[model samples]
Target: MEERTRAYLRGRFGDYYRRTELTPPPGANEREWGFIPWTSGPGTTMVRHRSLLDLGSIEDFLARKRPRHVYFSAGRYDEPSASSMSEKGWRSSDLVFDLDADHLPSVTLGEDSYAEMLAKCKDALLRLLDFLEDDFGFEDLTIVFSGGRGYHVHVRDAGIQGLEREARREVVDYVRGIGLDIDEIQTKEMRGNTPARVIEKDGGWGSRIHQRLTALSDDLKRMDNEEALGRLSEIEGVGDKTAKTILGAVSADQDVEGYTENEEVEINYEAISAGNIELGGVGMRKLIDAIAEETVSAENAPIDEPVTTDTNRLIRLPGSLHGGSGLAVRRIDRSDLADFDPLVDAVPETFVGHEISVEVTDGGTVELRGDSFTVEEGVHSVPEYLGVFLMARGRAEKGQE
Candidate 1:
């Protein structure tokens, strides 16, 4: 099982390492070990005296692998006091490195969907990459496997000292954006008989932007295909139908510049790519406006009538979300506050910490990033309790049975 997990980690995170974490002895509370003074800076060393994997040899692991980034993360939660796993709930789904508790949705979907959960994992990472590349521009992000079922992605370019609290906050929002998309995962309303292809299934909106950016950050490698699509489908203002329209244009390889905002939208990637420099805003706008209207057909006019690619550029749009190039947001700063350690004093701070985030780029492509590695459980948690319950009954009710 561990080996399979390791293989998946290596495949998902191009640059990363797997390390076991040590903790306090059998009976000692993690608090007994004392704290590692952290005002948030690069190269602040952490201590690990006991664990599934040893931390004492971490330097050797890094030296051997020569990885660019080292991220820590995990899927299970251990006993709150000692950082032990024996007494905790077996979490099927993971929260990963979102320590701040900000952006933690109140939704309790313990059984509604597993595919949805996995897709969310991917989208969360996609959003993270978007922010990391656009906002920080930090390069060579690598993830680490900190044992257990979690993972982390480390930005080797910026150590702890390099990452300020504000930057951490941005990361948290990015992650939340990914998770927030859970509200829109493949609902009944999204499927349709008319669902021909929107964007090419493999190469869609996010992929288009991802390919456009050179020096793709290691942070982006963590995103899987399903995650990217989840994000494309959940672009806030770009409802299901419209998001598909925009994605189709991108898949068709249309240049974003040629896209005009009007009642209808149109685009022809082959035309734009051919250097039809004359195809300016007016032409682009007309195409965009006519995109969704069935009434606006080739009968009125066709680019072929003028110049082969000149007026042939109109690509259709959905009547909804993709109506324009505009995007929408409910809370900008709300997501930004996600990663702050509001309860730093309460948790042990030991970690297998990997995470995901969201970022906006290219005015339309919302990117998600998965902190591509793992960190173990810290020494402690503040609330003094983790939600757990066990009950027994003499009789089984109809639904309970």
Candidate 2:
């Protein structure tokens, strides 16, 4: 970045801090704070190992420094400002999960637009929430848009604070569905004369698989006999003969006269729950394995695992501006998350009311503030927010009036 561009952003950032009231994270004084200053050259330097005491007031420090980026450690410490890790007393850390659009397997880089990537990241966020809220029953959650690539979830439930790194890795494994075995989740029960392996519908992975099985069965029951058989055959390991047997097993209980739709549904559920699907030559185990694989692929959240495991990781401050995107690293209310558009909502209100001239350097299409347009190499007068965004991203530079 040019010196003029750096100076302009530094000045604007200071102006933003002057007007913006940022709420510090809980126990801010006990956590180590860090910021990257607007230094010259291609490489940036991180000014870290500082605590809240060292900065005096957060607002004053930000206005004075006008840093390129700001962050706070996830781990709380006794001596947060200590110059070395050994000197800083190790304490508990918040369980943090990061969902980066660049890391998501569902996203296709170079092909997916920024909007599409963010949409996919939101889906992953919801899935991660399911594990945190329903499966783990964790409350006191804080969700924030990282102001650059994705979202961050901070789980501050008191019970998890003191957990060791290994314990945290286990949590990461569960969320990612690593080493998940269908047999481990199933229970053996006697169904008539045969001992059957049944999935407990109480909760957890078993409940998820059961739900998928129930839905699949409902759809199959609505189809014609031939169609349903054809659909069943599409599943791996289920050949024509196996498909016929499985279909018969699912329909065998439907022999009663005047069976209602609800009754058919119940029968299907019973078959799945009791594990009584009599696949003549093929075993129900193979079918369950296939469905379990499908369930994991569909439900697992692909979070950045290292972020969750690292006890001393530095994460972006919620209200600070991400110098890379010139967007607010904003905290999001859980209720508002579904409607939140990062490109629109994260744009700083500090830069919204005016226009500025910028000379586009590495130009391309930019989608921001609910508008999408292409820019080619030239000097253009655009919204101040757009100009700031372009300059921060190094795609443009400060232009004279």
TM-score of each: 0.24, 0.91
Q: Relative to the true structure, how large is the alpha-carbon lDDT of every model?
A: 0.26, 0.85
Clashes of each: 85, 1
lDDT of 2 by residue, 160-270 (tens): 999888999999999888899876787766767788667767778888888877776777767766776677678777666666556555556644333333332223534
Give the distance in Å from residue 72's predicted Cα in candidate 2 to where it truly belongs: 0.6
What are the runs in model 1 whose C-alpha is more than 4 Å off? 1-119, 126-156, 170-401
Residues 1-401, candidate 1, lDDT per residue (tens digit)? 12332232222222222331322222222111211211223343433222224333444443343222232222222332334434533222111131111111321365423223333433343444544555446565532221211122334342432333345444454433322221121112121343321212122222232222211212223443334334434433334444334424433344434333332333233322221222333332222222212112211111111111111111111110010111100111223334411112111211114321111111211111221112122221211111000000101101110
The lDDT of model 1 is: 0.26
TM-score of 1: 0.24
Worst 10 residues of 1 by lDDT: 387-396
Which one wins on lDDT? 2
Candidate 2 regions with alpha-carbon error over 4 angstroms: 188-195, 237-245, 248-282
